[model samples]
Target: MERFLAISPKSQLWLFHTALALNILGMVLTDMWEPMVVGAIVTTYLSIDATVRVRYVLPMKKVLRELEQENASLRRKMADVEQSSAY
Candidate 1:
C-alpha cells in the first residue's frame, strides 16, 4: 500500500494526461457522456493533487528539512559553548 501510494509527481502527471486523452477518445469513439464525465473527474483530481505536491507540498517539505538541519546545528553549537563555559 505504501509503495502504491508513493508514485512520483511526474508519474502522476502522466496519469492525468493519459486519462484526459482516453476520456477524449472514449467520448469521440462511443458518443457517450458518462465515462467521459467520470474520466474528467479523475483527471481533475490527479491534476490538483499533482499541482499541489509540485508547487507547494514538496517545496515546503524541503524548506522544513533545511530548517530542521539548521536548528540541529545551532543546538550543537550552543551545547559546545555551554560546555566550554563550564570550565
Candidate 2:
C-alpha cells in the first residue's frame, strides 16, 4: 500500500505486493481478463515453489546424507560402522 511503501520503500516483498495490487487495479481499470489470470498464476507458482523447497527439499537433504553414509558403510569405506561416535 501507499502507507507501507512510504514507510519501507526498498522492500522486495512490498514491491511485489504493490505490483500485484496494480495488476488487479489494471484488470478493473481496463476491464482485461487474461492479464489478471496470468498475474494470479505467476504469484501462485512462486508461492508453491517456495513452500515446497522449505518443507520438503531441505529435509530430504538430511535423509540423503544419511543414505550416503549407509551406502558408504555397505561398501566398507568407514573403518567400523558399529563403533560409537557422534553423528
Q: Global lDDT of each model?
A: 0.79, 0.62
Predicted structure 2, TM vs. truth: 0.45
Q: Report how far residue 84 has shifted in candidate 1, in Å.
A: 0.9
Best candidate, lDDT-wise?
1
RMSD per model, one decimal: 2.5, 9.8
Prediction 1 TM-score vs. true: 0.78
The true-versus-predicted C-alpha distance at residue 35 of model 1, in Å, is 1.8
List the candidate 1 regions with Cα displacement exceeding 4 Å.
1-7
In the range 1-87, model 1's lDDT, one tens digit per residue, is: 112367777687677778777887887888788968888788877777776777788789999999999999999999999999998
TM-score of each candidate structure, all chains considered together: 0.78, 0.45
- C-alpha displacement of 2 in model 1, angstroms? 7.1
Global Cα lDDT for candidate 2: 0.62
Error (Å) of candidate 1 at residue 25 is 5.0
